[model samples]
Target: MKAILAAVLGLALALPAAAGVTIDAFKTDSGLTVWHVEETSIPFVALELRFKGGASLDAEGKRGAVNLMTALIEEGAGSLDARAFAKARDGLAASFSYSVSDDTLSVSARFLSENRAEALALLRESLTAPRFDQDAVDRVRAQVVSGIRSDEKDPNAMARQAFDLRVYGAHPYGSDKSGTLDSVTALTREDILAAFRSTVARDRLYISVVGDISRQELGPVLDTLLADLPETGAPLPPVAAPAFDGQTVVIPFETPQSVAMFGQPGIPFDHPDYFAAYLLNVVLGGGGFESRLMQEVREKRGLTYGVYSYLVGKDGADVWLGSVQSANNRIHEAMEVIKAEWARMQTEGVTEKELKDAKLYLTGAYPLRFDGNGPIADILVGMQIEDMGTDYIATRNDRVNAVTLEQINRVARDYLKPEQLSFTVVGQPKGL
Candidate 1:
């Protein structure tokens, strides 16, 4: 399904905009913000709720507690057993999903409008009074441990772990969300409860609703669903700026190809030059084959089959990062070419043609993401999380369009740091 969406988005790059999605913003008395759009074509509602201090709030020695608790929140809640909860949800033809990432615990609910009340009741239980049954905790913990065991041998995972450890040091961001095998195995029920209390709270909530629902109907539902949470999250782990000092660390693996993850500090989401940096990223490395890194490493030198880069702008940290996989003997050539392109773009900004092409694709393809209720709801919550304005959906492409070539160049020089790039390579490579 995601591949199909990617294909449609590719087509959207050439096509002009459809009418922009009309998103309405509201707030409940409990201080929870809601972004809504009435897409009644489908008789279903998609709800997304985000709580801050997600996996990052895991207590000492309980690294994966938040993740484990999120997975079990819906497995059993209130008085319902895991089987009972699933049966109840399935009876209503509703779906509930919970996930925890480095920054947030995200809950997604989808249900037919006729079942809204029942579905919401289930969601409320999961949020406000999750049972965290010992049986469910044991099951979920085992699953996360299984995943950790799998990641231990995966080269890409190894490279990513090395990269984060090098960049963020001992910060929470550097910790794996699923945690280490020993950590997951040692997690206690009390730790899970503590993590749940600390992470799912009213002060950090962001909510969005889309599809067959009205503001009047949703207002009370919002308060009922969220009013029971704690007012504030536990103190988040301290913020630490990324410290990349251009060192290459190689993890030896018996493989034909070396996977390299390179990164440096990047501009934050709230920076005035963010949109410019976003546009600049496209020309520098985010444009796939059209990006300079791809042209230099793959099309020009044939050192790698593919290469790409992107910007990661979190609440307190940012990174300009990229990855490439190439034969062990050719990895050095690929790295040199990637570094050269990174340095070159800073010295000589992208061409006008490049700028126009990027703007055309970025602005034209922006609306394709709103083609479904779930995606739109997700995007709405994201807008609030990023502190963008209510009319941001309407004005976003204009912001992308407003970035001039000179501005791109200036931000490029200010932001890009080829010399500070740190590389973490997995596999036996010829050179570093």
Candidate 2:
């Protein structure tokens, strides 16, 4: 569960790059819409449900409510305590994973086709009638607090915290979804209930199912599992305007290796030049060691072990971000090389060969995402959340292939401003 769930966590936006598959879209009698794929090859089913406004829906001053609530949902349900719930779920050999990010709460379920009814019934209980007993709440809260405390002493986490603070300021996106110790310690059972009622409602739900499930068969199941939720949820947070200034901030930490996070504003998923920018990023840093950032900073200069950049498109904002770590004495050199690569990409953009290579890897890698039912289900759900049409899976590579060299260069020049890159470094260093 941990391994597979962690893999999917990295792929929330992975539909743009999935293997070929078909999607069936329908709305249940209860006004619940679901996108499904009829794959009868395997006698198993994978269902993914994404509810909008995740931890961001936490009430003001009750920052970690949604996160803690999500954790507790699988702890106990209806008449079952934690032990009973786990026993029931494992008895059926079913799997359920609940996770929350800044934008959404995701529920992923996998179970044998024969056990579908029982598994979904148990899941329904968890969703609509989570016990949230004081004991369960205390246990999960303690785990969350422990993780938060551990992050305080982590250099990479410290850099990320500093970077988010500078970019998002007072916006919900700026803070950890898990909340501070004081806030989590102050949370009450009522706060957890409020977060649940505000988020696990029908109006915020998006679902996708795959494997041995027919559209007709799935419609009723959808209502059974979801119809009881509230018809609406709390309003989403306002759009964030990320602030990416061209300055370096260094936080002194007692670590041998310094970690640095850098970023600038970026385009959204729907922007016309988005595909072009995506390809350009592959050339810049996202292509692993083949990327210019890796080549210039690691392979050539030996300044850092690795340096990579990626485009992050969240519900409220989009930004170009990157990270690197090096000996305190060499982190400055790594930063200099990264900035130089950034400027070079902006001015020269990607060459024809670089663009061609990026297209090959991105197109080739997308199909692997359809290796099984679970991946297909997750991809389809992400596509729905991003509002991509059903045809996206079939014609995705076409879109990637259509990004011409001219388009890539134009997007690079317009979007990648080296002068605007902000650096947040954690750990003691000899020089700036």
Instruction: Kindly list the per-residue Cα lDDT of model 2 for residues 160-194, writing each as its tens digit.
Output: 98899889998999999999999999999999999
Alpha-carbon RMSD, each predicted model: 3.9, 3.6
Evaluated at residue 260, the lDDT of candidate 1 is 97
Error of 2 at 139 (Å): 1.1
Misplaced by over 4 Å in model 1 are: 1-20
Candidate 1: deviation at residue 337, Å?
Answer: 0.4
TM-scores for every candidate against the unseen true structure: 0.94, 0.95
Residue 428 lDDT in model 2? 89
lDDT of 1 by residue, 264-319 (tens): 88888788899999999898888878888888888988998889899997765888
